[model samples]
Target: MTLFELTNSLKRTITESSYGQSEKHKLLQSEYVSHRELVQFYQACNPTPTLLSLIRQTKLHLPKYKTYKQTKTKEFLKMMEKLRLEAQEAEYRKLINPDPEHTTLYDTSNQEYVSPVQAHKELKNQLTTIVNVFISVGSVSYAVWYWTASSWGLRDSYRVLLTVFFGLLVLVAEVVVYMGYLNKIEEARAKESKKKEVKKVIKTYDLTLDNLTAEKL
Candidate 1:
């Protein structure tokens, strides 16, 4: 075909395409100085239309289209949440593939489970118990000192019993604080697991949307 025929055919396709008015405005605004590059891009699908169009045609909708303020706010917040989730997924991918020096081992030929942290924790608990016994003994010694020096004799059995009870209370308080620390650790693990599940759910939704979009096109 002649050059003029080819150019006319390209213009025809561009003018007949499904680009929106705002999109056409942008394309026409940032067009090449020569006017030929602009025609080429519009005809060849060189650059995609704006993300707004794609989103509108998908399961998502725009806020302006909704009349109620509450609906608009909800839609805007949902959009932001989706964007934030996708961003976190991208960040997770970057973290998983940080550097070539720290490649992940995928081979499962020789697998052996190890729990060094759990083993260390068990040992630490045993040591903590030993320390608690020592603390209890020390408290008993203090109680005995006070009882002997402050005019309390073995004849007053109730006073000696009360002192022993207070010493046991101190040991119980220490154990309660130790148990709180373990509870905090468990809460942190649960939070991390929840985040992982949320990420997985978002990724699955994105994949389903992508497949639907492909089918539609």
Candidate 2:
């Protein structure tokens, strides 16, 4: 039979039957009833949309229905508790034994992870090497120029002194600029570390009964 005809037939059977009348009154008065009782009263209604609408109108609660909703709520709470415990355990583990990979910062420019402390030290070493090279080259060039000027009878002591002074000033300026760059990196590292400490880690859980089934097919 079509769903419409089946629904009407079930309604007529319930209205005409003496037993259905008593059951219907009991179903309405009680807060909860067994799933089997509800199905029997409704003459084994398939619980399609029409039957569901009729059940809703009666304002009756089935034990199975209540249990189903309660089960979902309990599962959701359990999932949340599990996630909370996992997060706590992960944080405790990190405090006890810190991961080296976690300690390293991702360098976007270099497309690699590097330890902030190591990077700072390496940069300082490179700067020292560069400064030494510049000083050695400048001193040698100045000595050669001074010797050449003296031999050509073109030596000016004041001009030589000024050249040396300006070269020293330029070297100092370069060192100051590099130092400022290194300071910026240090500041950024500190700020990022602070952010990590305060950052909230988000976790997700699926509460839907997407894969749930009453029986295996």
Candidate 3:
């Protein structure tokens, strides 16, 4: 065939096919991108108009088309909630009977980097506990001194009993304060442990969103 005839035939074939018309609708009705993938897709896909058009004809509506939200039917919502509950129950089971051989998908920060401030904080907590113990002992000694040296024999039976009770009250107050300090220390330790156990999951950052934005020109 002649070169001119061949070129015309190719054009006709493409025109007859669904090549020019979009395969996808104006609103992306087929697939969904994960929240984790949004930043990657936004940066990479915004530059290539042909690729964006092929994927969906709604590239213009990207930044405003509710990129982060998902609206579902009642049935889907119920199913998702049920599945979430089942997954939570499975996690509880795994915690109760953790298999040593099985590898877990989640990981903790196995880093050995130590901060000086944190070390100092831990030392301070230990020193505080020691000080609290000594303070409690001193309080008990003072209570005993008040009961014995503050006229135990001279006072009536009722008066002596009342003085002994007041001394005991001082000891109890110190004990209660020490117990409260211990509880607070435990809570802080638990919080720090929890933070260390959970690894920080990250997503793509520093996206060129200006390219996706509508231009006046």
- How many pairs of residues collide in each model? 0, 0, 0
Question: By summed lDDT, which 10 consecutive residues of candidate 1 come out lowest?
Answer: 53-62
Give one digit per residue, the lDDT tens place, for model 3 in 1-217: 1111113332333235343244213112233433333334334434334434323422222333656777799999999999999999978966864554444475423332347898898799878876776666566655655656565644455555655566567667767877898799878866775662444658765456674463423
Candidate 1 yields a Cα-based lDDT of 0.57
lDDT of 1 at 101: 40
Tens-place lDDT digits, model 1, residues 109-182: 22233378978987988798869766885777577657765775544566666667776777777678778887
Looking at model 1, the pairs that clash are none
Q: Rate the local accuracy (lDDT) of all candidates.
A: 0.57, 0.60, 0.52
lDDT: the better of candidates 2 and 3:
2
lDDT of each residue in 70-180, candidate 2, tens digit only? 446888899999999999997896686465554446524323357899789899889786978598658755865676577665557765665677677767776787789
Q: Identify the runs in model 2 with alpha carbons over 4 angstroms from their true place.
A: 1-98, 101-154, 197-217
Q: Of models 1 and 3, which has the larger lDDT?
A: 1
What shift in Å separates residue 109 of candidate 1 from its native position after superposition? 18
